[model samples]
Target chain A: MYRLTGVTKRYRRGDETVDALSGVDLVIEGGSQLVIQGPAGGGKTTLLQMLGGLDRPTEGSVELDGTDLARLPEPRLTRIRSESIGFVFRTVNLIPALTALENVETALVPLGLAAAQRRQQAAEALESVGLAEHRDGLPGELSGGQRQRVAVARALVKRPKVLLADEPTGDLDEDARDEVMSLLEGLWRAHGLTFVVVTHDSAIARRAPRLATVRKGRVAVRERGPAR
Target chain B: MFFTYLRRELRCHAKAALAVALGLALGIGLVITVSSVASGMRQAQGRVLQSRYGLGTDLTVTKAATPPTRGSTPTFDFAGQSGSSARGDDLVTVQGSRSLDASVVSAVTGQSGVADAAGGLSLRVVKADRRFTQGQARQGGDATGVINGQHGFGGYGGVTAGQSGGGTAGQGGGSRFDADDYRAYGVDVSRPDIGPLTSARITSGTGFSAAQADGRVAVVDSGYARRNNLAVGRSFTVSGSTFKIIGVAAASADPAAEVYLPLHQAQALANATGKVSTVYVRATDAQHIGTARSAIQKNIPGTDVTTSAELAAAVSGSLTTAANLATNAGRWLSLAALAVAFLAAGLSTSSAVGRRVREFGTLRTLGWSSGRVVRQVMGEALVNALVGGALGIALGLAAAYAVSCVSPTLTAQVADAPGSGGLDQGGKAVGDVLHIALTAPVSAATLAVAVALAVGGGLVAGGCGGWRAARLRPADALRPADALRPAA
Candidate 1:
């Protein structure tokens, strides 16, 4: 579970101090899915950064499982980010030099797993994403949809408690985006993970059981309709 | 995973890696070539010194030659000889050196740091053989005629007091004179290892035996022996005493003498029974030759002592110039090249890191520690350095080998430079000019230094790139590329 109390994030661009996040409160129960929607630069990605422990809030506290992430030391924060949070960027960002399988294995490296076990787990994760046959292919050799699948495998391979994805299908076409969304919906339900996604797509937002809209660094939560 | 990533990254950026390696290789190759040449120069200089000083002679003691008195020329008088031909010889001490007391050798040997000392008498023998017809008186009239057989103006016998009467000498009465001169060194047979004999290697027969310390046997120099048609078992007369040629010697560079004799016999011929022209001293430690020279000089005042270093300073020629170039300009040039190479490598690495900002940021977001990222960057840099080091070593070895193959001859004038006051201080010219082949030898130590430089260069380049990678923030990857771009 994550609890946010008066969360605020500020950025200094020269002499101007712009507020990327404002004092907004929210709570997210474990094993629940939430989709955040907002305009460009409306603090959508900033809010995701806070939830993933990638960045600290300027004011107030962000508690994950009752531990305040904003106040945690950098090493402890990194450890929590490594062991508890998994992130998927809008860009696939797979290492171009590594094979698809090796790309997925990178996430498990921080977990200190044995090489054989890491390989086994990475293969299984790739199989789950339907990219098991393309395990040895480089990202350049894979198509747009296949590369994103590798990224998804890399994110979920470590089995973190929370999966924070920033514009996961923003660069994909309609078909690929729907395919990725369905894959994420199925994986979330199967893993019982706390899934939070930041996207501009209304279709993706409508399918979430809970929705949060961020504007001017403040969030407004609403109960969502039934799943599509 | 670390290795795989590093390997793949280097392969992806092969051009950049190769550029860095080639730069480092150029620097290391220059260093090796310059140092190896310098080492070869030192070896050549040592050979020049050994020519005159001999193998074990570390210092030499002598007194400056006294100015010759007027009318000191050798005279040949054939008076009261029964035969038609008369032969006579004169032995003179070597020029540019005065005799030292024979005891000076023992005194130098007793000095601190002095291992052994031997005295040698350097002399020159001038042999004159002449034939003359006895003057006969003949009567003639008028114009004064010449008489060529007599000594004192032919006795002016061509004219009489009253009438001009000519006196004609007998037919075939003109005198013929033949002269020969050769250098001879008197060796201390008991301790020949520390004297002039050390400079010559006997090529035929046997050298002096201990029992023959005062014997009438002599060793002849090969060149002089060939000229005189003298061989072992042949006899040569010096100052009316005959000595049997027992051996022939050949010198590597400067032949010390035309003939070598026992000290007692040479002393007897020169009429200086207890005198030596030079005292060659050997030191217990070659490194302490200066100390031994000082001790010998202090023990015997008014005597000049010369060391090998003093002789080297007196040498001048192309060899010295090349040595200077290798030591000064070559070293500085190599160092400058290396500095530039290292700087280029560092800047290139830093630029590579900048281009990979997105990639490094994504790795950070994936929970890779700062240390792990840094290690990956450094691993790639290390591989480049090692490859460059190997290439540099091969280039250096090839360059050195080529130099040896060419073997250009360098001329060195040792210990005979004008205005070198050392000559008067018992430092004799070993050879007026020597031709030594230049060689570049790569020593083990030079290679070791090359390897160390390669490793150090790698570390420097790696540190630059790793610092940039380690400072990246994981959150930066979450923002859009344009969003993170700073406002201009």
Candidate 2:
């Protein structure tokens, strides 16, 4: 579970102080799915970053699983990100130098898994995303959708409690987008994961049981489906 | 993990590795070749000096020769001289005398450092024509010295050669034909005090007995013997005396001594009887050679006293140019080359890190700490250095061998240690001078120094690369530049 109490993020741009997020409060429960929708520069990614323990609030506090993430030291924050958080970006950010399976295996390195176990887990995760035959293919050699699937596999390979995706379908064709949406929903339902997606795609936002529309550094509207 | 990352990185950037390696190899190769040359010259010089000093005799002291004033000493009219003068004229020419005989020898032998002393005459026969034949049966044996221009044993000054005869003719027809000439030295090889001859490595016959006074026995030098077709026991005639050849000995410090005779006989042959010109002294211990040399110089004021070390140094003079280059210019050149290799490696690695920021950020996001990333870069540098050092050593040794093959022997003029005043100038002899031969040996010490240099260069470059990577923040680095706008 994650909680943000009156959280704010401010950055100095030369002579001006800009508020990336201000006076926002939110809570994310275990195994829950949340979608944040906003136009460009609408603080959607910042909100997701704060919830995922990637950044700290300028004031107030961010707590994840009962630990105050805003006050945590860098090392403990890094540990939380490594063991509990997984990320998928719009660019299908699998390392181009590694194969699909090896990219997934990389997330397990910090866990100190044996090489054999790591490989087995990576292969299984790739298979779960329907990329079993393409485990050995490099990101550059795979199609847009396959690369996105590889990214998804990499994220799930760690078996983190929470998964965060930012514009996951931004660069993919409609078919790849559809496949990624289906995979994300299936993983969320089957594995009891806490899923948070930041996107402008209305269809992805519609699929989430809970949705929050952000405007001007603040959440303006919240929606919950029957499933939530 | 470090090694795995290093392997993948090297494969991706092999060009950089090869470029650095090639640069290091060139510098290392030059250093090895020069070091080997200097080492070889030292070894060869050591051998020559050892042979020149001769065995058992640690110091040589010979009296200065008088100007013979052989022709005439010209008086200069200092008030506007008319004659043409050459550059670098000799001022204050010291007069020499054949006075280093009994008294001087006795004086040196009695000095505190002197353990023993032997004196002998060294001179050339003025009229050793063909009449210079075998000695009588009462003497040691027979005398038969070479007598021909073909043998390079021609008459000295204007001495005419005569027909070969049985000494009876020497009492009569002495100047009809031109006879060969021979440089004669008088020494008792059996006496440890008598240097030059005492250390003669006998290739054939034997030496004179200390008790034997027959005086007709001789020791022919190896080179002179080879030229004159003389063997042990062969009789030769010189200065009208026949000596039965005792042993064909290796040449002494001065290679031009073609014939060696008993001290008494040498005194008689040069017709300077009861007089010896040079006295060689032996010290009690090796370390005391210098002490003895100094004492002898002080005891016999006008004598040239040269110790074995000084003799050795004289041969080393031939390699003065090479030694200077190796010691002075060579060090700076090697350092510059190393600096070049290090600078290029650092700059290239820094640039490489700049290009791979996203990759590094990805590693960071995947749980690699900043320290681990720096270690990866450092490990890559160290591995490259090790490989490059190995390659450089191999290439360096090869270059040394190639240099040695092209230049095996180097010749230099031997300026006898300041003292050999009355002794023959060894360099003046035809076909003989101080020869410093070379054989480059790659000592393990040299290899160790080279390897250390290579490693040091690599570490320097690695440090630069690591420093560049240490300042990057993964979150900001991973984000695209267009995503920098203020969030809504």
Candidate 3:
């Protein structure tokens, strides 16, 4: 579960102040899938970053599983991210040098898993995403869809309480995007994972059971729909 | 984890690692090479002075006889202008009449810890040929015949005969020879324990016997014999008295190109009966050298005693003044090594850190503590330094060996001899040259210098990188791919 009460984030741009997030109040129940749909600068990525405890708000409070993220020290916040939050980036889909399996294993490094168990878990994570044959292939050697699948495997390998994906399919084609979205939904259903995807695709946004639209650094709309 | 990271970093930055290693190798290699040469040369010079000047023993004593003092009265020119001229003072004035008898020297020999004793009569001898005037000849020349008989001449005519022939001569010639004079006086040649007068290497024959020791036999140095064409088994008459040449001795630091003979024979030949100018005494062991010296001085009364080590030190001090010019000349090489090492580390580390700025920014955004990041970077630097230092040490030692092999003059300077044949076999083990003769472990001081350079380089790198990473806004780091903007 995550909650943000009147959260505000401001940046000093020389003489003017730019509000990245202003007076934002939101909440999500456990095991729920949410998509924040917005344009490039509509603060959707900012909201996702705050929910994952990667950044602190200047005002108001962000609570993750009832713990205030703004009050946590940096190391503790890192621990929270390590144990409770998994991130999927659009560009850095996986570390370029590491294989798909190793990319998954990297998420387990902070978890203090044995090498053998980490390897097994990483292989299983890749298999779950139908990338078992490509487990040892580096991100650079993989197709765009495969890279996105590896990123999804890496996100799910840690078995975190929440998964934050910032434009997970932004670089993929329409067909590859559907496959990536399907893989994400499959993992979400199989493991009961809470997903927050920041995407500009309204079609992908409509698939989520709950959708929030961000405009001008504020949540402008929220709607519920059947899971697709 | 540390090693893993180190290995990864090294693999990724192979060029930077190699650059650092090469810098360290050259720097430390030069240090070891130069230090080895310097230490080796010092030891070599020390050995030459010690062996030639009788520096093996601990004590020596000369009879207390005041040197002649210059008169205060000024000399007058033809104009009757009375003034002191630089040449007016006779630099070679001889004085002191009180001489120690052989018995007194023998008494010093009887003291505890006294290993051997030698009595010497020092006098300036004028050469007959004047080809080499003012040459010093030791009263006895018998020992010279036993070692390098080719160099010793028997009689006074034999000296001229040997000189004219300029080759090996017939035995028992008993000819009056024209060899140079100016000899150092010592006890019988059979005594090997005498301080400061021990024969380093016998070029021709055995030392003098008691009969020849008390007789007219003498041992001349190789330098004097070579110059005068003296040979063994020849007799040379001095002052109308014929003396046999038994052996020829090599010249060392003994009285600046002098010859050697039995003390009594020299005393008899000099016509200064019952006079002893100096005495050589050796201590039984190093520890008792001082005690023996003090006891001899006390017994002799009014005599100044010195040790062979003290004499060697005196000679070394004099020689160091001349050699200081050479040592100072090599300092520029050391400065160059330092400069190369410093610059290499600076450039390599700066470039490496510059490339990793984005990675460091990501780590900082991921909540890595500043201290942790600093430690990680410094750890990488330490790894580089240690590896580089190890390579440097190996290369330096090899360079030192190569230098020694290439330059025999350097070996001679280090070993204190021409051949250095015995030096190879003399110490505990061969090629153990590094430990005693060349570079000792204490010479690892170069490693510390290297590490210091690396640390300084790492700090600069880390500081620049950390400053750049810390200036990044967290929002930019966490933004979506399309939304994220590069930092100003």
Across residues A1-228, which tens digit of lDDT does each residue of candidate 1 receive?
999999988887767777888897999989899999988888898899889887788899999999999998877877787788888888889999899999999998888999999999999999999988999999999988889889999999999999988888999999999989898889988998999999999988877789999998889999876432
| Alpha-carbon lDDT of model 1 | 0.80
Best by DockQ: 1
Candidate with maximal TM-score: 1
Candidate 1 vs candidate 3: the DockQ winner is 1
DockQ values of all predictions: 0.42, 0.32, 0.31
Clash pairs detected, candidate 1: none
TM-scores of all models?
A: 0.81, 0.69, 0.62
Alpha-carbon shift of residue A83 in model 1 (angstroms)? 3.1
lDDT of 3 by residue, B42-148 (tens): 65556555654454546656555344348732222222122211221111101123356657678888987887776655544433321111122233333332111
Interface RMSD of each: 3.0, 3.2, 4.7
Docking class of 1: acceptable
Q: Which model, 1 or 2, shows the larger TM-score?
A: 1
User: Cα lDDT for residue A67, model 1?
Assistant: 99
Show model 3 residue runs off by greater than 4 Å. Answer: A226-228, B1-5, B48-177, B181-343, B360-379, B408-488
Q: Where does candidate 3 chain B have its weakest 10-residue lDDT segment?
A: B86-95
Better of 2 and 3 by DockQ: 2
